[model samples]
Target chain A: MVKLFAISVIRRPIDGPPDGRCVLLKGSYDLASFGFFQRASVKEFMSFSSQTIVERTSPATRQSVKEQEFFCHVYVRVDGLSVVLVSDIDYPSRVAHTLMTKVLDDFSSKFEWRSVGPEALDAYRDLDQTLAKYQNPREADALTRIQTELDETKIIMHNTIEAVLERGEKLDDLVAKSDNLSAQSKMFYKTAKKTNSCCNF
Target chain B: MSVIKKVHLKGIPFNILPETLLLAINMSPIGGDERNGSNFRKKVVIIDENVAELCDKILQNLSNTIDKDDLLDEFDIIPCESKLNQSPVIHDLTSHKVALESWCVPYLFKHSYHQFLWICRKSRKTSSTSSSSSTIQSSNSGPRRDSGNIASAKREKELSRKLSCLSESERISKGLLLSRALIIINPELTLAWNYRRDFFHPSSLEALEKEQRFVSLVMSRKPKCPEGFTYRKWLIKKALQKSLVEPSRIQDFISQEIDMIEQPIRSYSTNYHAWSYRFWLLELVLTYDKTVVSKDQKEIMLDRELQKSNTWIKSNVSDYSGCHYRQKLLDCMLNFCSDGIPLLLKELDENEKRIFIFEGHESLWHHRRTVILLSINHLKKCKDNNGSNAPLSSEEYGGLEALEKTFQDKESDLVQQIESKNYNDTENECSQLNFKLCQAHVKWMERRLKWDLTKSVHLEV
Candidate 1:
């Protein structure tokens, strides 16, 4: 079955880089195999990835990450409020970006994102429902149909997470250097990549 | 000393060469009783630059690791040059999920070469002789299982000395085992599949069952293998021709075949081989053994399959193969009986809702088109097969009028639905691809088939 694993609303401040403390985040981590630690590991990876991509993203621009068998889409509004969704490879990229945009527009309107801090904004529970509703991709049909008329070429496509990074920097070095990731999370990252590169389970 | 038992080898030419080399093989006895771990332990490695060495090395491991011996399950053929520092691995898919651990083989399969490697585990063993003096070598426990260290050239020469010293019949038996190993590693090797086929002569029920089990293990490793499915079909057809299975149990046999194929379909998305194999199985049931499977049973089985297809399509909405299959089932159902009209109506209703929700998918549209065409053809058949030149009574035309109303509603609402989706699009610049495709389907039905579902006159019987 197709899956939409995670969704988050991250704010990219005018600073060195956006922190991992996103205003809103929700995901389903049942796809991972590491018992008990699966959710946390998936959360860590998604947060780490979202923060990295959100920082690189400019205002009013959108980009997507197409990894091995999964895709991560990040669509940021002109106000710097970003929405990110990670789904399986077969999920339509256009529908995914459309969901992010529609959710961003609706979520931003309901809550005062500019004035509220991360703690206050976390009280908004619409993201969990949004992720569940859009997991089918059809639930967002009405909005996506309208989004189809827009110029899809405006969305940039990067084949790998490494492609979005600056030159001379590897993803491994970043994972090892990041203070936000725990030692176990980094170990999970290494093992997951190693096992997948040779023979996928 | 190896066991003193009768093992015959049907020989094949060993002159042809292989592309690459490095083989890691672990053999499990094909028969159920070959677990003594004492026979076939005389390892013979050959020192040659040709493919003959690969065969000799296979026999060495086959003897060293095979506790009992009939046939072994070959896992993978790893190319030796990658330097992965990993040995040949076997995934026990029967009981595990998200797991691909290397299983323990009594004898380690070690290949230190640059060309070809073969891996195996005993599915079953059939040898009765257990008088050998070799000790049971415990399998090493690790994430990966090494086949064994590179065979020493001196030991290989010593083992060959024994082979040269063997009786003439023993030499022939060894040749048969060598071909078996080679065929499993490369299932696509048709020449070898039929080569071993002539050797096995699987006419008896027991032998055919054993062969089926052996092929199933190979399929588990490679789920979408067309060759595997085709081989299975050949076996079943042979059985049917020979009347090996009872006629009463033929339905159960075909049902079992359908059950076996679902695994491959589930493992690999949009599996063409599995789906085609399914269609063939249904066709076989329809045509074969009609004496026992009454018309009612056939219809019942078809109805069940239609429901199964819809359930599968619901979960795997993106898989168009399932939709294609569902359409085939629809064709069979409608052609078999007129009760199919109501079921067709229910199916179109579900498809209509699905199209509205997932309009981005072309599969739903394609299936919907097939169903509409089928319904139009059904109506056309009714009108053409009029018993007399008189128009039908009101009751005779009621069911078809319902169908006509549905077609009219769909055609009229399609344009409105497309326009309502986007506010910026006007009538002149409307370029909704989904809507356009639906319109094309309607046009093709009227212009090509010459039977328009949207018109009431076409349904008058």
Candidate 2:
């Protein structure tokens, strides 16, 4: 079931205070996963949310959507395949990682092209079930193609895990420092509510 | 013997400890209870040893507030106590003094101190077993007698007071008191019924179980009262919901509710609300049963329901919601009217057109048309099977004639009204439905006439 696919995450910056862009972005992402990305990009970005520019003075803003168009050139290039996605809002990094994971998972499951994580294993299991039910020559050939891609993802996951494991105490120290910072941030939020004021951020 | 000196105690602070110094006082005793003409002298005053000491304290307190010489002229602060052993002044004390206290005991209750003060006169005149018998002595002007009686009296007074303050349990007790009071006053105070409702909340399993018994009690007392009937309706409706998905369980719940409404032991009067609730219960029964019920049983039940609610229906004829329930009861009776068409016609006022559930002023006409059409359908079925020689009797013919007259009258009026009105934009769905029924009834009657004539011709041949 393996198929050749592309996945990436991009950061798009907007000027307004975070009124409602995150909701539109999440909707667009869900639509895109359902193979409705192009339709959603126009409607959500132009009609639903503030991702549109008026009268086409700036060609760059007019290129794609008013929101994603600004990041018009931000794409990830890997194995000669490029993919564009959303970033630059609050939780940009987390959203990017999740989207990348979903896309990678989808590609590995569909085409058997895998790089890291359990995506290859899931694809193999699905293929195994399908083969049991179908028992077609075409499906058998697809499974053989996926097997080749699966090996590549397994090696990538192992390498990533090994690299992270090598970092040891430095990573733990960084995580501990982040926890402390978050605790302080919560205290600041409490103080703001007591003083009847919004968060400074 | 001198007269029993009357005393008044007022404005004692709630926080003060009670002083037993006045428990030993003596006064004149009552002689007998042989009607008004009985020769009973007022007993002579006997200032005992114990009462005298308490009287000295009373004098001291009176002196502290005012001059001692002016005490007899002003309101005298008298100290009274009952003696331990039975004595005559003890009877005198019961006639005059009241045991008033600021603080209350925890549970045992008696009449209010003011009420007891009124009862004191009766207690003194009647008997020596009066509670004041234990502390006062004749002819000894000193404070020396049993202290135990004083302590117990204080305890009894305190207990009665505490009973007054039983906040949580007060409502049920108060409701019972008010119920008894209502029987004495105006028994028609529906507020007493509401007081009973407020006594229970459906918060716990125990409360729900108790609520069942509570409803039974209320209905038992006042079966015709709307409050009890409505509350029972609510309980049955709740039980109906829990058992709604199952038909037999719903039937059982409905039967239980009907029993509460119909067979309340103490009061046997039927309630309109209860009858209407039974109607609603039957509707749900119809929905859930989805199976045919016994015709005889259903008719009997509906007849009883209508008879019970007849007064309410007559008063609330303009109440369309209530009319809707009547319509349902009619429908149930109709189901049982399979054996005899006359029974159905009678239940529906012998006017088929008035049996409909349509809204607005035309509902009577609409309903009448439906009933006529229904009769025509049944008669045509009878004629189709050539059963004119079968069970077709006077009752059936009379039922047929009534249906035909109702249909013809209603149809002529409806047609006339429709012809006069502009039907371009007015989407009278109900009128349209009635028109359909009118057409159906006409066609059925035509067929029935043809069948009946053909059968008669065959008989003549």
Candidate 3:
């Protein structure tokens, strides 16, 4: 049986069996992860595994998923609950490889979580690269909006400090004047640390 | 009693001079003359020979044709002859037949028969009394009064025509003739001086001199006359355009104009036009010297100027002319020294209220930029002379950084002053000072970028 792994995994009603239902997430590994499981009804798991080739790929997977990598939305009924696994049966083999790599990366890179084996890693890599290639504008737009918000908050903090100093007030008294500034500064410190790590490489 | 006076007796007149006969009327005078038949002697004046002849012929006929007895009994023939322009004058003689002897009267104007006829009727009521009033009244006629009135009107029209015959050149040559007349006629006419300036020809030095004189006169009359200020401005601008072509003539023009502008004491600071001319002069002087002026000498002059300007600003805070001078002085000072940043800051501090201060910090900033470049140049020069001796120490740069901070602080203060209008509206020092601040900011930024500080130094931005 084909399996997927994710940290912070949860189940929800499937909106569709195609591209929209196939959700993609990207972050530092500690933030979030995903996993997949096969149901008992899949009897031909061995044959499917033999047909699905395990592979590795470059991160710059600038292409769409091929048809052979699609996985079935397998339902597993436990007690009174029915859950559908989030993948398409018709996904290309390369997409299966990409998705599998993405799952293993989520587990090893951050908090310990269920690990997708080599076959699923190949599928995840394909899936992530495909999604990234198609969603360049949307990703860039979201990043810009967040950065503008951050810059405005930083300006406000700088102004408040300047005003306090100009008035000959002690810096310690600033907390009583503005809690927003203190919270924003904490956020800035965390982001700075993250940015430092990312930039160092 | 015969009222007429006649004397005919002569000694052997017919035998002595047979061809000539003279009959003379005789009177001693109106003053109690005694004329007993043979002793009477008088002369009667007649109008002229023509009137005298006619009177003589009628008298001879009256003697011969009338019977002597009848003439003697019915008519008292009083001899009368007319005299003109002599005292006690008789004007004409009148006669009638003996039956109408009551109508007979002496007519004074008998020399002309038509005048005699008019006088005869006029004398009828006046013969027994004095007659001069009636004769005086008749001689002055209606046409004479009409003619006199026409002549006066003609004389007035002729006088006006003569006045307008003169051209503008002639009128201006008359020396503030229009404005002076206007002052006399309408002293409140402000535009009279303006009209005089317009009528002045741009090309004529004579007209220019007249314009200057006209303005001078107006300003002399009322030192605060705005029209005088405007004309003075026009003269300066015209002079500038003329001087631009031949620079050698500029000195004379400026000297002449300086006298004109300086003459009015009250308007020295308050007159915008005069102040503008002064500012123009400083600009001209700066522009002329900029190319050839040496740095050390220029700095000394600039320092002197700044000191002089400080005194002026203290006395007359509204003097905007010094605005341009302070700006030029600052530029000259910065150009003079390599380490001029601190000096410039100190100078700016001295006259914190200089109009340039509140102006865009651009000029100040540009001056700062220049100082920075000069510092760099000085560094290069020192390196060229002795690489080891050159002061490339970062501590020196730190000192400059401190100076830069002072400049920024001063600029902020200037901006606040502009915002607050920390100046009397009567004196517009703050606005100009604001512009200098902006100019200083720009120049400082340019200098900072030039020093390659932007690349290595992380800006807070």
Specify the highest-TM-score model's number. 1
Q: Rank the candidates by TM-score, best first.
A: 1, 3, 2
Q: How well is candidate 3 docked (DockQ)?
A: 0.00
Question: Candidate 1: lDDT over CA atoms?
Answer: 0.58
Model 1: residues with Cα > 4 Å off, grouped in runs: A5-14, A17-27, A30-55, A58-70, A75-84, A89-201, B1-87, B90-94, B97-186, B201-217, B242-244, B387-405, B422-431, B450-461
Q: Provide C-alpha RMSD values for all models, in order.
A: 13.4, 31.8, 49.9
Model 1 over residues B1-461: C-alpha lDDT tens digits? Answer: 21222222224222222323333323222233343211212333233443335444434543433323334333432211221222223222332211111221212222221111111111101111232432232222121235444454343444445455645345434544544444444455464455454445566776777667666655554667776887889888888888777888778778877887776677567887889889888878776556778777787778778888988887566788888888888888867765566677778778877665555567777787788788777766766767232223314446555656666566546534554553344332113555556556666667865546445322211
State the local distance difference test value for candidate 3: 0.35
Candidates' C-alpha lDDT: 0.58, 0.34, 0.35
Best-performing candidate as measured by lDDT: 1
Classified by CAPRI criteria, candidate 3 counts as incorrect
Model 3 stretches with alpha carbons more than 4 Å out: A1-201, B1-162, B165-176, B180-217, B220-226, B237-246, B259-270, B285-307, B317-343, B352-400, B408-461
The i-RMS of candidate 2 is 39.4
DockQ of 1: 0.14
Model 1 residue B106 distance off true place after TM-score fit, in angstroms:
21
**Candidate 3 residue lDDT tens string, B186-220:** 22455454544544456766556654654554443
TM-scores, all models, native as reference: 0.60, 0.25, 0.28
